[model samples]
Target: MVVIAVFKSSRPEGKSAMKWFGAAQQRGTVMALTALQVVICTVWLTTASPTPYKNSQYITSKIVYECAIGSVAGFSMLLGYIGLLAAVSFLLAFLARNLPDNFNEAKF
Candidate 1:
Protein backbone atom coordinates (compact mmCIF):
# COMPACT_ATOMS: atom_id res chain seq x y z
CA MET A 1 0.00 0.00 0.00
CA VAL A 2 2.78 2.39 0.86
CA VAL A 3 4.53 1.48 -2.36
CA ILE A 4 1.51 2.54 -4.36
CA ALA A 5 0.96 5.59 -2.18
CA VAL A 6 4.54 6.68 -2.71
CA PHE A 7 4.10 6.44 -6.45
CA LYS A 8 0.56 7.90 -6.51
CA SER A 9 1.89 10.87 -8.44
CA SER A 10 3.33 8.41 -10.96
CA ARG A 11 6.89 9.67 -10.77
CA PRO A 12 9.69 7.47 -12.07
CA GLU A 13 11.74 8.55 -9.08
CA GLY A 14 9.19 7.05 -6.78
CA LYS A 15 9.25 3.83 -8.77
CA SER A 16 13.03 3.76 -8.70
CA ALA A 17 13.09 4.51 -5.01
CA MET A 18 10.67 1.71 -4.33
CA LYS A 19 12.62 -0.66 -6.49
CA TRP A 20 15.92 0.12 -4.76
CA PHE A 21 14.40 -0.11 -1.30
CA GLY A 22 12.65 -3.39 -2.01
CA ALA A 23 15.73 -4.91 -3.59
CA ALA A 24 17.97 -3.93 -0.72
CA GLN A 25 15.48 -5.09 1.88
CA GLN A 26 14.72 -8.45 0.25
CA ARG A 27 18.30 -9.66 -0.27
CA GLY A 28 18.82 -11.54 3.03
CA THR A 29 18.05 -15.18 2.27
CA VAL A 30 21.07 -16.97 3.64
CA MET A 31 21.86 -14.49 6.40
CA ALA A 32 18.43 -14.69 7.94
CA LEU A 33 18.35 -18.48 7.83
CA THR A 34 21.85 -18.77 9.21
CA ALA A 35 21.13 -16.38 12.02
CA LEU A 36 17.96 -18.21 12.95
CA GLN A 37 19.67 -21.59 12.83
CA VAL A 38 22.55 -20.39 14.93
CA VAL A 39 20.30 -18.87 17.57
CA ILE A 40 18.06 -21.94 17.78
CA CYS A 41 20.96 -24.35 17.91
CA THR A 42 22.69 -22.24 20.52
CA VAL A 43 19.60 -22.37 22.66
CA TRP A 44 19.20 -26.08 22.06
CA LEU A 45 22.81 -26.71 22.94
CA THR A 46 22.62 -24.65 26.07
CA THR A 47 19.52 -26.44 27.23
CA ALA A 48 20.75 -29.94 26.30
CA SER A 49 24.21 -29.96 27.90
CA PRO A 50 25.37 -32.25 30.75
CA THR A 51 23.37 -35.21 29.40
CA PRO A 52 20.54 -35.57 31.86
CA TYR A 53 20.76 -39.37 32.03
CA LYS A 54 24.52 -39.73 32.19
CA ASN A 55 26.15 -40.89 35.40
CA SER A 56 29.74 -41.83 36.14
CA GLN A 57 29.35 -42.65 39.82
CA TYR A 58 29.05 -46.40 39.13
CA ILE A 59 31.06 -48.41 36.59
CA THR A 60 28.45 -51.13 36.16
CA SER A 61 27.07 -52.24 32.80
CA LYS A 62 23.81 -50.40 33.43
CA ILE A 63 25.61 -47.16 34.12
CA VAL A 64 27.76 -47.60 31.00
CA TYR A 65 24.68 -48.21 28.91
CA GLU A 66 23.00 -45.15 30.36
CA CYS A 67 25.91 -42.90 29.56
CA ALA A 68 26.34 -44.27 26.05
CA ILE A 69 22.67 -44.01 25.30
CA GLY A 70 22.42 -40.50 26.64
CA SER A 71 25.44 -39.37 24.62
CA VAL A 72 24.10 -40.95 21.46
CA ALA A 73 20.71 -39.40 21.98
CA GLY A 74 22.20 -35.94 22.40
CA PHE A 75 24.37 -36.35 19.31
CA SER A 76 21.44 -37.60 17.29
CA MET A 77 19.31 -34.65 18.32
CA LEU A 78 22.07 -32.24 17.27
CA LEU A 79 22.38 -34.00 13.92
CA GLY A 80 18.64 -33.80 13.37
CA TYR A 81 18.65 -30.11 14.10
CA ILE A 82 21.56 -29.61 11.68
CA GLY A 83 19.75 -31.47 8.93
CA LEU A 84 16.57 -29.53 9.47
CA LEU A 85 18.46 -26.25 9.48
CA ALA A 86 20.24 -27.15 6.25
CA ALA A 87 16.98 -27.97 4.53
CA VAL A 88 15.37 -24.77 5.72
CA SER A 89 18.36 -22.72 4.58
CA PHE A 90 18.27 -24.32 1.16
CA LEU A 91 14.56 -23.63 0.69
CA LEU A 92 14.82 -20.01 1.84
CA ALA A 93 17.81 -19.34 -0.42
CA PHE A 94 15.95 -20.82 -3.37
CA LEU A 95 12.93 -18.66 -2.66
CA ALA A 96 15.04 -15.54 -2.42
CA ARG A 97 16.81 -16.16 -5.73
CA ASN A 98 14.88 -13.42 -7.49
CA LEU A 99 15.09 -10.85 -4.75
CA PRO A 100 18.05 -8.81 -5.96
CA ASP A 101 21.34 -9.15 -7.83
CA ASN A 102 22.96 -6.50 -5.65
CA PHE A 103 23.47 -8.99 -2.83
CA ASN A 104 27.24 -9.20 -2.29
CA GLU A 105 27.82 -7.20 -5.44
CA ALA A 106 31.01 -5.17 -5.85
CA LYS A 107 31.15 -2.13 -3.64
CA PHE A 108 33.76 -0.20 -5.63
Candidate 2:
Protein backbone atom coordinates (compact mmCIF):
# COMPACT_ATOMS: atom_id res chain seq x y z
CA MET A 1 0.00 0.00 0.00
CA VAL A 2 2.84 2.45 0.82
CA VAL A 3 4.64 1.56 -2.44
CA ILE A 4 1.47 2.10 -4.43
CA ALA A 5 0.95 5.50 -2.84
CA VAL A 6 4.48 6.60 -3.64
CA PHE A 7 4.10 5.43 -7.21
CA LYS A 8 0.86 7.34 -7.61
CA SER A 9 2.45 10.52 -6.31
CA SER A 10 5.46 10.13 -8.60
CA ARG A 11 3.29 9.72 -11.67
CA PRO A 12 1.75 13.17 -11.26
CA GLU A 13 5.13 14.66 -10.46
CA GLY A 14 6.59 13.18 -13.64
CA LYS A 15 3.76 14.56 -15.71
CA SER A 16 4.22 18.00 -14.18
CA ALA A 17 7.95 17.90 -14.88
CA MET A 18 7.25 17.00 -18.49
CA LYS A 19 4.92 19.95 -18.77
CA TRP A 20 7.55 22.35 -17.48
CA PHE A 21 10.14 20.87 -19.81
CA GLY A 22 7.82 21.41 -22.74
CA ALA A 23 7.22 24.99 -21.69
CA ALA A 24 10.94 25.68 -21.41
CA GLN A 25 11.54 24.18 -24.84
CA GLN A 26 8.83 26.37 -26.28
CA ARG A 27 10.30 29.48 -24.70
CA GLY A 28 13.73 28.61 -26.02
CA THR A 29 12.39 28.28 -29.53
CA VAL A 30 10.62 31.61 -29.32
CA MET A 31 13.72 33.32 -28.02
CA ALA A 32 15.76 31.90 -30.87
CA LEU A 33 13.20 32.96 -33.42
CA THR A 34 12.96 36.45 -32.02
CA ALA A 35 16.70 36.83 -32.13
CA LEU A 36 16.77 35.62 -35.70
CA GLN A 37 14.04 38.09 -36.61
CA VAL A 38 15.91 40.98 -35.07
CA VAL A 39 19.04 39.99 -36.94
CA ILE A 40 17.16 39.78 -40.21
CA CYS A 41 15.53 43.14 -39.65
CA THR A 42 18.88 44.71 -38.92
CA VAL A 43 20.38 43.23 -42.05
CA TRP A 44 17.48 44.36 -44.17
CA LEU A 45 17.66 47.90 -42.81
CA THR A 46 21.38 48.12 -43.43
CA THR A 47 21.11 46.81 -46.97
CA ALA A 48 18.05 48.80 -47.94
CA SER A 49 19.69 52.22 -47.92
CA PRO A 50 23.15 52.58 -49.33
CA THR A 51 23.09 56.27 -50.23
CA PRO A 52 24.11 58.88 -47.70
CA TYR A 53 21.63 61.57 -46.63
CA LYS A 54 22.17 64.71 -48.73
CA ASN A 55 19.86 67.25 -47.00
CA SER A 56 19.09 68.16 -43.39
CA GLN A 57 15.32 67.57 -43.79
CA TYR A 58 15.88 64.27 -45.55
CA ILE A 59 18.27 63.12 -42.83
CA THR A 60 15.85 64.11 -40.07
CA SER A 61 12.95 62.36 -41.72
CA LYS A 62 15.01 59.27 -42.41
CA ILE A 63 16.21 59.13 -38.82
CA VAL A 64 12.67 59.52 -37.49
CA TYR A 65 11.31 56.80 -39.72
CA GLU A 66 14.08 54.35 -38.86
CA CYS A 67 13.70 55.06 -35.16
CA ALA A 68 9.96 54.58 -35.30
CA ILE A 69 10.20 51.28 -37.10
CA GLY A 70 12.93 50.03 -34.77
CA SER A 71 10.99 51.06 -31.69
CA VAL A 72 7.85 49.29 -32.86
CA ALA A 73 9.68 46.11 -33.74
CA GLY A 74 11.59 46.14 -30.46
CA PHE A 75 8.42 46.71 -28.45
CA SER A 76 6.65 43.84 -30.14
CA MET A 77 9.56 41.48 -29.53
CA LEU A 78 9.78 42.55 -25.89
CA LEU A 79 6.08 41.92 -25.36
CA GLY A 80 6.37 38.43 -26.81
CA TYR A 81 9.35 37.69 -24.56
CA ILE A 82 7.46 38.87 -21.49
CA GLY A 83 4.50 36.69 -22.39
CA LEU A 84 6.76 33.67 -22.76
CA LEU A 85 8.32 34.36 -19.37
CA ALA A 86 4.90 34.54 -17.76
CA ALA A 87 3.89 31.25 -19.28
CA VAL A 88 7.12 29.65 -18.02
CA SER A 89 6.54 31.02 -14.55
CA PHE A 90 3.01 29.61 -14.45
CA LEU A 91 4.23 26.25 -15.66
CA LEU A 92 6.93 26.22 -13.01
CA ALA A 93 4.39 26.93 -10.31
CA PHE A 94 2.19 24.11 -11.50
CA LEU A 95 5.17 21.77 -11.59
CA ALA A 96 6.19 22.80 -8.08
CA ARG A 97 2.72 22.09 -6.77
CA ASN A 98 2.76 18.57 -8.18
CA LEU A 99 6.36 17.80 -7.18
CA PRO A 100 7.11 15.14 -4.58
CA ASP A 101 7.69 16.24 -1.00
CA ASN A 102 11.27 15.01 -1.07
CA PHE A 103 12.19 16.73 -4.30
CA ASN A 104 14.34 19.39 -2.57
CA GLU A 105 16.15 16.88 -0.40
CA ALA A 106 17.96 15.18 -3.26
CA LYS A 107 21.40 16.38 -4.40
CA PHE A 108 22.26 16.97 -8.03
Candidate 3:
Protein backbone atom coordinates (compact mmCIF):
# COMPACT_ATOMS: atom_id res chain seq x y z
CA MET A 1 0.00 0.00 0.00
CA VAL A 2 2.84 2.45 0.88
CA VAL A 3 4.62 1.64 -2.39
CA ILE A 4 1.46 2.25 -4.37
CA ALA A 5 0.92 5.66 -2.75
CA VAL A 6 4.54 6.70 -3.37
CA PHE A 7 4.27 5.75 -7.04
CA LYS A 8 1.07 7.70 -7.51
CA SER A 9 2.56 10.83 -5.95
CA SER A 10 5.75 10.63 -7.98
CA ARG A 11 3.88 10.29 -11.26
CA PRO A 12 2.53 13.85 -11.06
CA GLU A 13 5.97 15.18 -10.15
CA GLY A 14 7.50 13.39 -13.07
CA LYS A 15 4.93 14.84 -15.44
CA SER A 16 5.58 18.33 -14.11
CA ALA A 17 9.31 17.95 -14.58
CA MET A 18 8.81 16.77 -18.14
CA LYS A 19 6.64 19.75 -18.99
CA TRP A 20 9.21 22.22 -17.66
CA PHE A 21 11.98 20.44 -19.50
CA GLY A 22 10.09 20.64 -22.79
CA ALA A 23 9.42 24.33 -22.35
CA ALA A 24 13.07 25.01 -21.60
CA GLN A 25 14.21 23.06 -24.63
CA GLN A 26 11.81 24.92 -26.90
CA ARG A 27 12.98 28.29 -25.57
CA GLY A 28 16.61 27.33 -26.06
CA THR A 29 15.97 26.30 -29.64
CA VAL A 30 14.28 29.58 -30.39
CA MET A 31 17.22 31.52 -28.97
CA ALA A 32 19.65 29.48 -31.01
CA LEU A 33 17.70 30.06 -34.21
CA THR A 34 17.60 33.79 -33.55
CA ALA A 35 21.35 33.86 -33.01
CA LEU A 36 21.95 31.95 -36.22
CA GLN A 37 19.75 34.35 -38.17
CA VAL A 38 21.74 37.31 -36.90
CA VAL A 39 25.02 35.70 -37.86
CA ILE A 40 23.75 34.92 -41.37
CA CYS A 41 22.52 38.47 -41.85
CA THR A 42 25.84 39.91 -40.72
CA VAL A 43 27.80 37.66 -43.02
CA TRP A 44 25.60 38.48 -46.00
CA LEU A 45 25.91 42.19 -45.41
CA THR A 46 29.71 42.15 -44.94
CA THR A 47 30.71 39.83 -47.80
CA ALA A 48 32.53 41.50 -50.73
CA SER A 49 30.91 41.90 -54.15
CA PRO A 50 31.23 38.75 -56.26
CA THR A 51 31.23 40.59 -59.58
CA PRO A 52 34.54 40.75 -61.47
CA TYR A 53 35.75 44.26 -62.16
CA LYS A 54 38.21 45.70 -64.74
CA ASN A 55 39.97 48.26 -62.53
CA SER A 56 39.76 50.31 -59.29
CA GLN A 57 38.24 53.19 -61.30
CA TYR A 58 34.78 51.69 -60.82
CA ILE A 59 35.07 51.42 -57.03
CA THR A 60 32.08 53.71 -56.48
CA SER A 61 29.92 51.72 -58.88
CA LYS A 62 30.94 48.53 -57.20
CA ILE A 63 29.97 49.89 -53.80
CA VAL A 64 26.49 50.82 -55.05
CA TYR A 65 25.92 47.40 -56.58
CA GLU A 66 27.12 45.60 -53.46
CA CYS A 67 24.89 47.77 -51.28
CA ALA A 68 21.83 46.86 -53.34
CA ILE A 69 22.63 43.18 -53.14
CA GLY A 70 23.23 43.39 -49.41
CA SER A 71 19.89 45.13 -48.91
CA VAL A 72 18.04 42.31 -50.63
CA ALA A 73 19.91 39.69 -48.70
CA GLY A 74 19.16 41.45 -45.41
CA PHE A 75 15.46 41.57 -46.19
CA SER A 76 15.39 37.89 -47.02
CA MET A 77 17.16 37.06 -43.79
CA LEU A 78 14.61 39.10 -41.85
CA LEU A 79 11.78 37.14 -43.41
CA GLY A 80 13.45 33.85 -42.59
CA TYR A 81 13.93 34.90 -38.98
CA ILE A 82 10.26 35.79 -38.64
CA GLY A 83 9.24 32.45 -40.10
CA LEU A 84 11.46 30.55 -37.69
CA LEU A 85 9.97 32.43 -34.74
CA ALA A 86 6.45 31.58 -35.88
CA ALA A 87 7.35 27.90 -36.20
CA VAL A 88 8.83 27.84 -32.72
CA SER A 89 5.69 29.45 -31.28
CA PHE A 90 3.54 26.79 -32.89
CA LEU A 91 5.73 24.01 -31.50
CA LEU A 92 5.48 25.45 -28.00
CA ALA A 93 1.71 25.61 -28.23
CA PHE A 94 1.55 22.00 -29.35
CA LEU A 95 3.74 20.86 -26.48
CA ALA A 96 1.63 22.78 -23.98
CA ARG A 97 -1.51 21.16 -25.30
CA ASN A 98 -0.11 17.65 -25.03
CA LEU A 99 1.16 18.09 -21.48
CA PRO A 100 -0.65 16.14 -18.74
CA ASP A 101 -3.48 17.81 -16.85
CA ASN A 102 -1.56 17.59 -13.61
CA PHE A 103 1.22 19.68 -15.10
CA ASN A 104 -1.26 22.35 -16.16
CA GLU A 105 -3.14 22.47 -12.90
CA ALA A 106 -1.01 25.28 -11.50
CA LYS A 107 0.09 28.45 -13.25
CA PHE A 108 3.84 28.66 -13.81
Give all TM-scores, in the order shown.
0.32, 0.34, 0.41
Q: State the lDDT of candidate 1 residue by residue for 1-108, as single tens digits.
A: 233334442565455555434544555645775676677556656666544365656865555434333345656666787898778668766665554354546787
Greater-lDDT candidate between 1 and 2? 1
lDDT at position 53, candidate 3 = 33
Q: Candidate 2's residue-wise lDDT over 5-32, tens digit each?
A: 3444566564444443455676887798
Task: Please list the C-alpha lDDT of all candidates, in the order they appear.
Answer: 0.56, 0.55, 0.58
When 1 and 2 are scored with TM-score, the better candidate is 2
For model 3 the local lDDT of residue 9 reads 49
The best candidate in terms of lDDT: 3
Candidate 3 backbone collisions, by pair? none
Could you tell me how far off, in angstroms, the CA of residue 56 lies in candidate 2 after the best superposition? Answer: 19
Error of 1 at 50 (Å): 12
In model 2, what lDDT does residue 85 have? 70
**Cα RMSDs, all models:** 9.7, 9.4, 10.9
Model 3 worst lDDT run, 10 consecutive residues: 1-10
